[model samples]
Target: MTALFDVILPVFLVVGFGYLVCWRKWLTEVAVDGVMRFAQNFALPVLLFSAIARLDLGANYNPLLLLAFYCGAILSFLLGVALARYWLKRPIEDAIAIGFVCLFSNSLLLGVPITERAYGAEALVGNFTIISIHSPLLYTFGITAMEFARAQGQNLPLGRVALRALSGVLHTPLVIGILCGFAMNLMGLAGLVMPDGFWAAVTMMSSAALPAALFGLGGILYRYRPEGEMRAIALCCFGSLLLHPAVTFGLGKLFALSIAEMRSAVVTAAMPPGVNAYLFAALYGVAKRVSASAVLVATGLSILTVWFWLGALP
Candidate 1:
């Protein structure tokens, strides 16, 4: 109960607040869109870089932990695709979108802070490891799948595809921020004594990122209405809100993660679909409605699902 109120409640309250503002027309769609970009392009990257750079990961980092979490996530993504295409009979593009919503979690906006509350601040190192790679990996896999599904052909030019994917990733602020953090860590600059202003600015950005993201997420959700294959949306929400976490739990145990790591893993896996899932679907010119609906549905349902996982965690 404390876990629920301490972490989960605050996140949702901000989301609800965003919904209220939009409903009241106190903030226009244009205003919310600007906030969205700010949260995405600036605040989140700063927050991620600051967290990753400060932590002394040393012996705390675990390769097997990443392997387990990603394996489960990829498996869940594939399962969503299969269900959408085979059972729901959605088109290839929609199927790819379904896979993405299932794979991508709202780890940044709702994840990092909540996990810190659930486990402890040290849990952030584990959280950063997941956040740092989650986007780039998902982008590569989802983009490759979309391109191949659209144009099935000779050899598929995977090297070219990978390069193209790398290019997109290079431009993203989140990835750049992470790279900067890693570079700082490698150069031992993370340990250098910095001015109070430097720390204060990082703290401000990091602190602002989550709440702004949540509010911006609410605005986006309220602004978009669901218009797609209902069956596909249902399957996507199911995969995201339920099955992904289940698979992650089994994999976390199989990888022999610590109690704290498993708690972080399971809690993170249970997060709702991210807004970027819809962004990708829109970018690829398919499944936008289904993606948007899944984001909304998974978020609404996650309140119950999150509680289940937090209680289930040790």
Candidate 2:
């Protein structure tokens, strides 16, 4: 019970603050834009790098657990696509956005903070592993899904799409940060500690990233309400809130993960629709409305859903 409050409530508080600010016009879109730009371009990359750099990627790491997490994400994503297509009868582009929303979670902003509070810093390694896998999937398969939707009966430039997607992966600061961190870890260079001033600067900036991103998400939500898109948002939220977590929990149990790991996986799975879904929609020029709707609804609902799941975890 205490864990629920400790781990989950603070996230809601920050988001609520952001929402209020935006709703009251306390923070203009320009301000929100600037903050988001900073988060995406600077703070997030540092956070990713720090998390990856700190992982001890040797023998004790659990490959099976990693596989289970990846498989669960994939299955849930496909399930989302199916539901959007058959039940919602949405266009392919909208359906793809729905699917992407369900699959891609805000593991960084919400998941990492909650899990670290609940389990401890050691859990960051598993979280990082999931993000690493998710990043490539987001760039390649996820982007392709959007492109397919956007192609809209027209022939897709397969080679061009592939190249563009690969280029996106290459240019992502977060991905580059991860690669650098991994290289440092692999080369046994992580031991070379930075000077105190540099380390302090990194820590300070990384610490600010999550809250700023969450607040920016709230600002986005404020900018875009989900009133008209309720049906699609509901479906996407259900997949993210109920089905994904349920499946992940079951997989964790089947794989005999520790209680902590199971809890972590469940929380990770239950994260809200990622902000990246909207970014991808804009990039692919498909179903931007649906993507925006998913982001707003999922994020708004996740506060309660996360608290409930955390309460049930013991």
The number of the candidate with the highest TM-score is 1
The list of candidate 2 runs beyond 4 A from truth reads 148-158, 189-197
Error of 1 at 7 (Å): 2.7
CA shift of 211, model 2, Å: 2.3
Q: What is the lDDT of residue 229 in candidate 1?
A: 80
Once fitted onto the true fold, the runs of candidate 1 whose alpha carbons sit more than 4 angstroms away are 154-156, 189-196
Provide the global lDDT of candidate 1 against the true structure: 0.82
My TM-score estimates for the predictions, one after another, are: 0.94, 0.90
- Residue-level lDDT tens digits of model 1 in 150-185: 767556676777777778777888888888777766
How far off is model 2, as Cα RMSD?
2.4
- Tens digits of per-residue lDDT, candidate 2, 1-314, equal 67657877777777778888889999898998898888888898888877676676774367766666666677767987888888888777767777887778887888988888877887666778777656766667787766555666678788876776687777877788778767766655546665679668879999989989878767777877565467777777887887788778777878988776676678888898787877877776766777788888788788788877777665
Provide the overall lDDT of each model, using Cα atoms, as 2-decimal numbers: 0.82, 0.77
Q: Report how far residue 260 has shifted in candidate 1, in Å.
A: 1.2
